[model samples]
Target: MHPQDSPSNRPTPVSADTREANRRQDHFGSREAIWLFGYGSLIWKADFAYRARRPALIEGYARRFWQGSHDHRGTPEAPGRVATLIHQPGSRCLGMAYLIGPEVLAPLDLREKNGYLRERVTLHFLDNDLADNDQPDVDDPLDDDGLTTARTAEGLVYIAGDANPAYLGDASDDSIAEQIAHAHGPSGPNSDYLLHLADALHAMGGEDDHVFGLATALRRRMRQAATHPATTD
Candidate 1:
């Protein structure tokens, strides 16, 4: 764990809008097409076009529901939590990487404009046999050492760091679940996002304790809410 990423080493909140700064980054070099990583809603909801996609992982990061969503998943008055990567040395985060043309960045930037800044990362592809295109079984045990990486590609990923204004920071699992269960925005109920990501991770043969924990807590809260509805005065 890097000292900068320590749970208590949170930075001061800055501007939430990061579209312009992301556009200024010139890490793509001369490549006509580049890879983009999607660890959250992008895993299940691929609204944009992509040439190809594969299960991939990045090092030194772990997914957590610390970022607050005011535009898509919740309102300004009561924001919903969203997933973001926090540096955890030796930890690997599994996600999907899409091969896309450079032109795709414009719309992607807009969609993830809420505190998400484009970060250059090295994507380690999981499947060695990309030519076959056979999906990996979700039930199989994840053998990181036994797995052969087809290749590694430089890619861009959206990360909402602590500097962002919408960052909600760390919270207890029960507290995070409470916010997600009752929050709603244009995309829909915040619980839907949590549940969908849980399901997506299962389908992708990825195990995230934080995500699964929140999903379990959210389900329990939902059940209680269903059984004991608040009556109007």
Candidate 2:
């Protein structure tokens, strides 16, 4: 659910309303179609139209739950953490990419307006071999003019960098998970967002220690909350 659809106790949003900024920056130029990468909710709940979808990965980045959500997953008083990409050499993050027409950017910009700015990146589409394997082969593909070249494409991704007001920065997994366990907002419980993303990655044969670790921690907190309802209250 979008923040517009519900009553909000949220303060004037802390993050910049990036819809206008994103609209002005024609990152795709005159291209009719462009690839868009989804490493978070867009991976499972694509509320937009797309022509094609593929399992894809980006190099030199690691997904971290450092972005804060004041409108969707939690309130302004107690924001929920969400995933954002951090530059990390030798690291790769698996996600889904969509080939979409330029018109689709309008709604997406609004949905991710909370400090998220559109950034361009190179996407590596997974082949059948990589998809079927128990562990994805994340080695940087050879740059030869063959399969790697054919499977790679330039795309846009929404990123909430530390410069943004809603960036919570780094924290312990348990601390992040604890906040997720208690926070709720227009979209629902924040833990649901964490679990849904984890499930989506597992289905795609993706392995992310960071994501899976938080999921594990969140579940443990949930179980404890269930077992000791009075203590939780």
lDDT of all predictions: 0.81, 0.81
Candidate 1 structure lDDT: 0.81
Please list the Cα RMSD from the true structure of every candidate, rounded to 1 decimal place: 8.2, 7.5
Write model 2 residue lDDT over 2-98, tens digit each, in one string.
3333222224356567888899988667665778999999999899987567789999999999888888898888777788999999999999887
Worst ten in a row by lDDT for model 1: 140-149
Which digits, one per residue and each the tens of the lDDT, describe model 1 over residues 43-127?
A: 9888997756778999999999999887787777667888999999989999988877778898999889889999889999987
- Model 1 vs. true fold: TM: 0.85
**Best prediction by TM-score:** 1
